[model samples]
Target chain A: AQSVTQLDSHVSVSEGTPVLLRCNYSSSYSPSLFWYVQHPNKGLQLLLKYTSAATLVKGINGFEAEFKKSETSFHLTKPSAHMSDAAEYFCVVSDRAGGSQGNLIFGKGTKLSVKP
Target chain B: EPEVTQTPSHQVTQMGQEVILRCVPISNHLYFYWYRQILGQKVEFLVSFYNNEISEKSEIFDDQFSVERPDGSNFTLKIRSTKLEDSAMYFCASSLWGTSQETQYFGPGTRLLVL
Candidate 1:
């Protein structure tokens, strides 16, 4: 089974400060991880994905995540908090090794709040 | 950029009534999917469709749920009986391929409120 756990239910950061959202995953096989963001009343937008190729994945809007196999973690980060960055962030994992249809298993999500 | 689109941004329905949620995937995409998020809950995969049939479905996708690509461009999900617990934000997504490496683009989603 593939599952992801988002460590924080909510996080708040001041504008221009750094931001971090923690996620840990459990997978029986090698997993593909992704970070997606959803703004109020908007659909989820893919931030980045980690296949086997890259450890540090860059995503849209100055967001990035690092895949650490030993830690079983893929934590999303940003250098500076922007007002538009406030949204719900989901950590997802897919079990490509199972050869099953790629259905994503998601975490409960972390709600980010940017303070001015 | 081409993106997936869903209709009826908001819908309120009585219990036991049927509801059909519609989506138009990216023109060239071959795989389509449906997911939903209950209030404050994780987004869950309901079903995946390809080759005009269901390729995979989660436990939540029961007999009450059915999917159809009746036309070349439209994909629809019909719920035979609405339940109060069914209230959630339903999202439609599409990918060029059905691989883990493929990125699934999502739509704005339809907020379904079952009364």
Candidate 2:
């Protein structure tokens, strides 16, 4: 079965420091991976997505994620953490087997906290 | 930028009562979807619709749940008989097309409470 695993339930970092949120995925075929961010009481915002285009995909708000097929990982990263970057992050994976819009399997989610 | 919009920021209803959640997706979006997030849980996909029909649905979406695009501008999800387990934040989303990395814009969501 296709699944996503977010290694950290919660990650805390100081402002101006690097932020790393780990995610791993398992799929039956080629995969489409995505990262989404949600603020308190708000809907999800797409941070970035990787679809066999580039190994390193950049997203909004100074966030980026690298899709490493060999490792079966798509870890999100930021060079510097900001107070505004505090939010819940979800890693999702979808199968691209036969021109289908496959359902996404999401990880439990990781809450990121940036301390000033 | 155009964004999806959901109505009734909050709705409180008794179990067994019917509830309808409305949404207006981006004008150009062709694929629409419904998802729910129970308190303290991951968001789950309920259903996906396109071309005036349901493209896919999950086990959680049963006969009691239905979706309709009555007109061109509005999409609605109706729960014929609500249950306590139905309480959650319902979100409506839309994407330009069904692709591997297509971004689905989400609505503000409606928080439903079953009492």
lDDT of 2 by residue, B1-115 (tens): 7888999989999999999999999998998999998988888889999999999999999999999999998999999999999999999999878665677888989999999
Q: Candidate 1 lDDT, tens digit per residue, A67-100?
A: 9999999999999999999999999998565344
- Clashing residue pairs in candidate 2 (N, C-alpha, C atoms within 3 angstroms): none
Q: Residue A20 in model 2: shift from native, Å?
A: 0.6
Provide per-model DockQ scores: 0.66, 0.57
Q: In model 2, what lDDT does residue A39 have?
A: 94
Off by over 4 Å in 1: A98-100
lDDT of 1 by residue, B45-105 (tens): 9999999999999899999999999999999999999999999999999988788866788
lDDT of 2 at B23: 97
